[model samples]
Target: MKQLKSFIKKEFFHIFRDPRTMLILFGIPVVQLLVFGTVIKSEIKDVHIAIYDQSKDETTKEITNKLLSSGYFILDENLNNLDGIDAIFRKGKVREVIVFENNFGQTLGKEGTAKMQLIADASDPNIAKLAISYTTAIVNDYIRKLYPEMQLPMQITPEVRMYFNEEMKSAYMFVPGVMALILMLISAMMTSISITREKELGTMEILLVSPLRPVQIIVGKVLPYLLLSIANAFIIVLIGHFVFSVPVNGSFILLMLETILFILMALCLGILISTAAKNQMTAMFISMIGLMLPTILLSGFIFPIENMPVVLQYFSHIMPARYFITIVRTIMLKGTGIFFIWKETAVLIAMTLFFIAVSVRKFKIRLE
Candidate 1:
């Protein structure tokens, strides 16, 4: 007990004594939270829209007024022809083009029907969907008000209540994701680099020549990072709860256990990288480029996997962080238990085992 306590104390000193390390350990979570919360928003606001109103009638004017008043869209251009619609979108400001048929009001009065084409840029599917939905709502509302006596053949009103996230704030989605990412960054990447640093500095040889077993040395080095990552995870969750008013609807204990599982997976990945790399620089490079980029881009962190290209979607299936993020979101936001995320949890366990096996093999080869 005394020896373990002494080792823990020494570990704390090593972490706190280095200002750079201390800053990275403490500062990364806060920075990531702020960046994700404020800067990275999924919701579309004031999306530029072009109107090609050939009718120039009272109905068209009223519809335009309603659309402009909705606040979700901004009328950027009054396009005179179909040729100009493509040019406006190509300029990159307009995301949607609303085209009113030439005889819109006359058709509505005579035929009791009018057609308006809604052209949306589908490059960003989420934003495109939102723009279409908002525009449809605006037009439908106008139609309801204008022709109260008219009844459509099919009338369906969707009452969408987003559970766990009433506001559907992007911050709620990113908070858990950022937590996983930062913990991985600190625990796995930093630990791998730090261990490789000792090896590069020739201190690993001295420690190997000592009575300390390789496993003991590895454990001692990783233990501090593990504890620090747990602390950072707690801090991020607390900040998300207090500062952003993000709720933890599920069991806090379960959330913590799942977070630890993910942290262990990341640490194991770091060990694998460290074993494959010859020096600290190579380890750091592998961690940043190989691990971090995939986590951010391919793990469905910032983009939904359902909408990704088929090849990229397939690529994301193998990323450990993808499962970890899914588990965190399910547990924290959806208030689900082991049953809901068991498959993802199983996947994480499998990845951890795979990484551990590969790392152990590489470490043995190095020893030989």
Candidate 2:
């Protein structure tokens, strides 16, 4: 009994002494709690919307005010004409556009009914559906509150048009996200494990001392995976387009270029991870735990990022998957070209350069 107790105490001391163990035991739980608790929200908030009120009547103004004030939406633009609706949605900032027909207040007063169109950017169907529903509810609430004692039933008929994805296919949303997730995990994990395996097997020192420069060594390790990952991406896209019926409405070349950029960024990130990791297990652990969950959750893969708390939303900015998912969705669903996605493209480029710089520095330090 005494010996067993001593062994248990020694085990506890070892666990407490290892920072990684402590982090796995405690830090992960706390982070998961905070991430899950704050990130998973059924309701959408701060949804950017455009209003094209043709009537410019009192009722149209009132309904617009109600939507903007409900905390569920923010007015991104007061569009001048219906002609720009397509352009606005392609830009990806506005989620829904509310258009009130001519003489909205007058029509409601005379006929006890008015027409309003809720045209949503359904590239992200969930947000579009939620925003449309919320807008409809607010309009209904407005009619009820304004006509409590009226005998004639007043109604605002909302016609919903889900742009980009007319059928609101779930596959349309998840395919791009799944593509991002698969590429990020596979590319990053394989590259990290490959480099770390060299370190663990003591071949990294030989490579370091050999004729190859650090950049060359890194490139040599990453090149095969890069080509393989690009092939994997092509297969995924083909499957998504043919089997799942997800559209590749944009330039296929641009899509491939963006995918390559994202894959390179992910591979560079893996190299950075390898520099810090001493073994395959550690590299795998960091790749899986550090990249996977964030890619799935914070990347707006399943959950909407705007619905999350502001801090979590801001934190998601650093997640490479977030930008890639946006890029993929924009190209696949919206068919928008480089003009629409230049910012996201730039972000991925910057991340790739940053990761390469850091990984090279860290690898040199290890070589020293």
Candidate 3:
């Protein structure tokens, strides 16, 4: 027991004595969290819109006000004619245009029929679809409220047109998921292998001969990797924001805390793997084959869990990455709080405990 305590102390000296190692442990996770949060979002908001109101009626004006007030659209220009509509879209400031037919109010009141055209840019299909959907709902609600007394069949009509992301760009969904997978690979797998490498190289034996315990040895070895993983998380989020234009809908602090928790869980798993591995190559192979592939294929990161075969869906339950991805997505994209994700967090905590328990048992056996 005394020898084990001495060994852990020496390991701390080795880890804290190296600044580069320390930075990597802590920095990478922060970078990855930021990158994933900012770069990878599916929701669209504040899209620019133009209005070509031929009727200039009270109903059309009211509908326009609702669209702007909904906070989903920004009115960029008012077009006098269709000739300028194409040019306005070409300038790229406006993503959608709303055109009200002439005699809109008169037709709705007298003839009980009116039509409006929603022209959208189809280049980015997801945003275009959401914008059109929102616009149509707003117009329909206005029409229904205006003529609640008169119930006429097929009286109000909205014609929706789409632009950009015509296919709804499933890429938008996958990018953030991929970011999560990458961070897990780099943070958990790499750290595990690096720590095991020291053991295989005989350095761990020297530390064990010194004045430190096994726990301190493990902590010192893991601290640098933890920092690096956090840094990587931040970078992924930044790229998601500036490059992909993904929004951080949730509290930044909450997202960070969730990320850090996942990182710690992953590191614990890495330590467990290290305890099992005989060498760096073995550690790397186990981490990659055991953790990475399951994370990519089974975690519902890229594929919807509900759509998967029941057996595979059940299999995904064993994957920690699955829960981490869920936690991150809910907090970062969906803007959910602890109340929404407590179950996932609890699962992660359990997994961390399991890994630590197993690793400690293995380490003790190895020492004996």
Candidate 4:
């Protein structure tokens, strides 16, 4: 009995003496709660779109003003002719466009009917659908103001046209999604567990206190996993190609480059997790429960983010997998290059830098 009590006291002392371990044990749950609380929200704000006003009338102008004022979309371009529409889409800068029919207000007043077009660049079907829904809601409010609690006898038809995936294949949606899932699992989850294993076995302290710089150690630990993740990405593409008959319509080089970028993002996230985790079990739990589920569920992989509760949709924005999935789908199905995916790529880059910076700061704080 005396020996057992002494052993338990020694164990408690060892755990409490290390501030890093104490911080990891107590700090992680709070961070996760704050992150989940702050990030999740179901709404789109300030999406970029364009307008083609053929009518250029008071009513059309008023509707346009209302759309802009609703704060869902920002006007990217205004077209006087149809010639610029294709160019605007090619630039991949705009998500949607509203085109009003000729003499829109005059026709609406005289005949109680009018026509407008909602042309959405359906490269991202989810976003396109959401933007259109918001537009429809705005148009409905306008109708209520004009007709006074009755449907307009003459319709103001909103003709919606989808640019990509007219057939809307499940493959077009799930293949990219699966790729994002696999890469995140392999890169972030596995690397985090590996790093935490060193801490469990007491080698992490040795590595940290050794000759190698902390940044170099982190990079070294993550590099092999980075390469492995890249290979796994290509393997997924090949499987998606040969097994599922998924086509690689875009440039392979661009696809691989994007894959590498996503892998780096995941690796940085892994390093961040390692800094926050005291052992392999905790790392695995954080990676699996904290990160993997979000990658699969909140990244728009299975459920359309547009359909999720508003808070969940907002939470999805912070999932690195969400942007990677969008990039993969745009490249594979839409056959677009950097011009189309640069925005998503830039987002991943920004996240990678953020994670790396945070990891470095945490390491410095611990050492100090």
Cα RMSDs, all models: 3.6, 15.9, 8.3, 17.1
In angstroms, give how far residue 73 of model 2 lies from its true place.
33
Candidate 2, residues 109-164, lDDT tens digits: the string is 88888899999999988898999899988998898788776545474556879899
Q: Specify the highest-TM-score model's number.
A: 1
Clashes of each: 0, 0, 68, 7
TM-score of 1: 0.81
User: Per-model C-alpha lDDT, please?
Assistant: 0.85, 0.83, 0.76, 0.77
TM-score of 2: 0.61
In candidate 4, what residue range of length 10 has the lowest lDDT sum? 32-41
lDDT of 3 at 273: 85
Write down the TM-score of every candidate.
Answer: 0.81, 0.61, 0.59, 0.56
Q: Model 4: per-residue lDDT, tens digit, 1-368? A: 45344433543454457575445333432343234323432346688889999988889888999999998899998988878888898899898888899998898887777898898889978778889989988987896797674564685757666556654445556668767766776678766876787778987777667665676666666766676667667766876677556688899999999999998888888888988998888888988898878887899977889999999988999999999998988888879889987888999999999998998888667665
lDDT string, candidate 1, 1-368, tens digits:
45455655776787889898888888867987887888777666898999999999989999999889877889998989899977777888799999999889888978878999999988888889989988988898888788887877796767889988888888888887798789888878887887788789898777677666666666677788888899898999998888887888788998999898888888888888888787988998898888888889988888899999999999999988899889888888888799999899999888878977887677667666
Model 1 lDDT vs. the true structure?
Answer: 0.85
lDDT of 2: 0.83
